[model samples]
Target: MGRIIAVANQKGGVGKSTTAINLSACLAEKGKKVLAIDMDPQGNTTSGFGVDKNGIENTLYELLLGEAETKDTIVKDVVENLDLIPSNINLSGAEIELVGIDDKEFILKGITDKLRRKYDYIILDCPPSLNMLTINALTAATSVLVPIQCEYYALEGLSQLIHTIDLVKERLNKRLKMEGVVFTMYDARTNLSLQVVENVKENLNQNIYKTIIPRNVRLAEAPSYGQPINIYDPRSAGAESYRLLAEEVLNREDN
Candidate 1:
């Protein structure tokens, strides 16, 4: 079965979607069959792969609502070996709509379970909140990968997210694990960024990825151009960091 990783953080602007996009792209470049699911209503990950979020049909919304089949909803070869299940503004209503449904949290799990045999990795890009959609992602995923920006208030927000994960592990998915934490938006020039990394390492104290994503202009610019960092500027620091991150992920599985 494929590993389903939910790239999540309840805090916004913490490189969650960026990590989901670039990491999935990098892994695909490594000849892994990857599928990226954009569960966020903003659909940034969808657009990052050059899929027009607004104009797309048979999106995640339809799949979640049982209106469409997974095969029909998927956009294949989004970038070489990567496939995508795009999301759009329509997903914004999923939270309210799922409230009265039976086994609501397992909806995503059921959908992904059927898809496990088709890929090596399934990456879910969750929204920046611990709502029904995020709950579904967490419930569906075998592990959660958190992207923490090296900045103030990082740990403050993390505790709440950890608590939610604990609750999910206890009552929802016993197999769910915190895969690891990746530090993003690092600025070596700033003392604050360095301090934040040290502090987080002291607190979390487990599975912190060694690859620190620097604040590179090329990384931010790639999204606007609808390409992954490797395609946009393979020689840039941002691309190298994600490449290292992908290798680190593969090494972890190997060990």
Candidate 2:
């Protein structure tokens, strides 16, 4: 079975989408069969892989509402071994539509469970908020990879996120675990970045990744070009960090 990793964070602008897009791409580059699911209604991950959201017919919206099958839903050959289950603005209304349904939280799991054998890693790019969509991702995932922005409000709501994971583990998906926390947008010149890392280490008793993604111009520009940092600018600091992160993920004995 493939490892299902939900790259999640309640706070926006924490490089959640960036991590999802690049990590999946890097893993694919390393020859792992990857399936990146765009759980966010904004569809950043969908476009980050160069898939046109407006031109696509079926998306995660159709899949979640049971309007489409997983075979018809998946966009094949997104980039080498990486496939995609794209999402668009249409997915935003899925929150209210999911109500009163039987096992709504497990709907996404039902879809992903079928595709596990075909891939090595299934990466879920969850929304910035803790909505129904995010809950669905959590229920589907084997582990959650959190991306924290190295800024002043880095620790905000972190405890709540961990608490939610615990709740889901206790009730929803007992297999769910914390993949780890990864620090993003680190600036070597700033004393604040170092402070944030040390603070999180002192407070949060979780597996933290050693590879820190620095705030690079290329990383910010790659999304606009509809490419991962590795493909967009292979020599960039952002690309190198993500590649290192992927190695750590692959080296892990748990998954």
Candidate 3:
């Protein structure tokens, strides 16, 4: 069975998709068979991996709606060992369509259950809202990884997110757990960034990652080119930071 992780955060612009894309790439580089699931309707993860969303016949939307199987929708990415179950604007309608279905939250879990044995890790890039899609991802995941940006109002929506997770654990998936919180877009020179980090650490009680992703222009520019930071600029600070984050996650799993 694979370790299914949902990369989620209710707050937008917090590097969730970026973390999902690069971390999945880095894990593949480390010889792990990885499947990146784009649960966000924005399809940033789909485009980030250089997948032509407009041309794809089947995607996560089809899989979730039981119109297609995982094997049919899964596409091999440019990277050697990484596969992607891409998403697009079509998924935006899934939320409304799923409303009438029984056990709608388990739709994603049902899809992955048949395919979990093929990959070492299944990374889900969740939408920045606690919608049905995100709930499906949460129900499908073994744990959730939160990417929190180092900003003044970083913790504003965290309480609600945490509450939702607790509710999911109580009612949806009893096995769901929090992987950890990652601090993203950190700036060492900014006191605000430092304060935000400290605040998150204090609130989460040290359930935060040691690797802080610094604010780098290259990280922001990679998406425009449809590439991960590691491929866009291997020598850049953002690339190195994500690589380190990959190692941190792997090491933590080992112990």
Candidate 4:
């Protein structure tokens, strides 16, 4: 069975989606069958893989609402071994609609249960808020990977996220664990970035990944071109960093 990892962080602009898209691509490049799920209403992950959400039918919204199956909703990405379960603006209504439903947090889990064994990795790009959607992602995930930017407020809302994870582990999925925290948009020259890294290490004791994603313009531009960094510019620092991060994730599992 594949490892279901939710790329989650309640704080916005923390490189959660970017990490999800690129990590999935990098893992696919390394011969893993990857399925990237866009659980965010923004649909950035859907567009990141060159998928158009304008006229697509049966998105993640339908899957979560039990109106569609996981296989029926998955779309193939440009990458050979990578596939995606795209999301669109329609998903924004899921929070309100799912409220009165039974096992609301398990909707995603139910959808993925049958499809989990088909891929080597299932990467969920969670929304920026700790809502029902994120709860569902946490409930379905075997582990959560948090991408924390190298900024002043890096650790600000971490406590709340950790608390939520704890609650999910206790009440929803006991096997759910934190994979690790990755530092993105890292600027080595900035003392503040260094301080933020140290602070995270001090608190979590798991400092950060050795592969810090530098603030590269290409990284930001890739999504605009509807491509992952690996496909946009494989030799660039952004692509190399994500590939290294993918290897780090794979290595950690063996140890």
Candidate 5:
């Protein structure tokens, strides 16, 4: 079975979607079969793969609502060795729609189980909130990878996220683990960025990835071009950092 990883952070604009897209792409580049699932209502991950999010008939929304099967909803060859379970704005309604369903948090778990054996890594891009969707992702995942941006509010809501993870591990998925934390948008020139990294390392009891994602223009531009950093500019610092991050991730299970 594949290692299911949820790339999640409750705080928005913390490079959650960026990590989901680029890290998955980097893993694919490393000769692994990867499946990137977009659980965010923003649908940026879906569109990042150059897929038309609005026109798609089969999406994650349909899967959650029991209107479609996982196999039927998968968009293949979004990038080489990378498949995607795209999302759209329709996913915003899933929270309300799932309220009445028994074992609602396991819906994604049940759906993803069917496809696990076919891939090496299944990366879920969770919404930037501890909502039903995030809970569903947490329930389905083997571990959680948090992407914390280097800024003033970096640690904000982190305790809540950890508490939720602990709660899920105790009651929902006993096997779930904290994969690690990776710093994003780090600027070497800024003292604040350096301070944030130091504080996070000292405070968070989780492994912090060594490869900090530098704030680079190419990284920011790749999404607008509907491509991963490597595909957009393989020579760029963002691409190199993500590639290194992927290497770190590939060895995480060893640690």
Candidate 6:
């Protein structure tokens, strides 16, 4: 079975979606079959892959509610060797709607389990908040990839996030583990950025990726153009970093 990674962080504006979009694209570029699922209500990952929200007839919301089949929801070849199950604003209400559903947290897992053999990697872009949707993603995922912004309070709420992951692992998905933490928005020019990195390494016991994503205007502009960094500006530093991250992820898995 392929690895199912949930690119997750409860904190906002930490390059979580950017990592999800680009990592999937970069892995696809390496000739690995990848399927990215947009579980975020904001749908930035959906738009990042150039999928129009209004035009998508079948989405994660319908799939979770058992109203649509996975085959019908998947947009194949959204990027070369990459497929996407897009999400939109409507997903915002799915949490309340799922309140009474049986095994609500496992809904996503039920769907993704059937899809494992078809791809080398299945990346899930989770919501910013630790809502039912995020829980669902955690339940479905084999591992979690957190993107921490290289700024003050980089460790804030990090303990809680790890505690939650521990709870989920203990009670829900035993297969779930923290894949690693990747530093984002790193500025080699700033002492604070380097300090934050040192602090996290000292305090956190999780594995850390070597590829740190720098702050780049092109990375920020890619979503506006509806493309991943690798496709939006392949020569950009953001693209190069993500490609290196993909390589490291593959190597980590093999080891």
* Clash list (residue pairs), candidate 1: none
The Cα RMSD in angstroms, rounded to one decimal, for candidate 1 relative to the true structure is: 0.8
- Per-candidate TM-score against the hidden true structure: 0.98, 0.98, 0.97, 0.97, 0.99, 0.98
Q: Tell me how far the alpha carbon of residue 207 in candidate 3 is from the true structure, in angstroms, after superposition.
A: 1.5
TM-score of 3: 0.97
How big is the RMSD of model 6?
Answer: 0.7
Local distance difference test, each candidate: 0.94, 0.95, 0.90, 0.91, 0.95, 0.94
The per-residue C-alpha lDDT of model 5 at residue 67 equals 96
Report the C-alpha lDDT of model 5 over 129-153, residue by residue, as the tens digit.
Answer: 9999999999999999999999999
lDDT of 2 by residue, 1-255 (tens): 999999999999999999999999999999999999999989999999888998999999998998998889999988889999999999999999999898999999988898999999999999988889999999999999999999999999988888988998999999998999999999999999999999999999999999999999999999899999999999999999999999999988455
Q: Which ten residues in a row have the lowest lDDT in candidate 1?
A: 153-162
Weakest ten-residue segment in model 2 by summed lDDT: 246-255
By lDDT: ranked, best first = 5, 2, 6, 1, 4, 3
Q: Which 10-residue window in model 4 sums to the lowest lDDT?
A: 202-211
State each model's C-alpha RMSD to the native. Answer: 0.8, 0.9, 1.1, 1.1, 0.7, 0.7
Model 3: lowest-lDDT 10 consecutive positions: 200-209
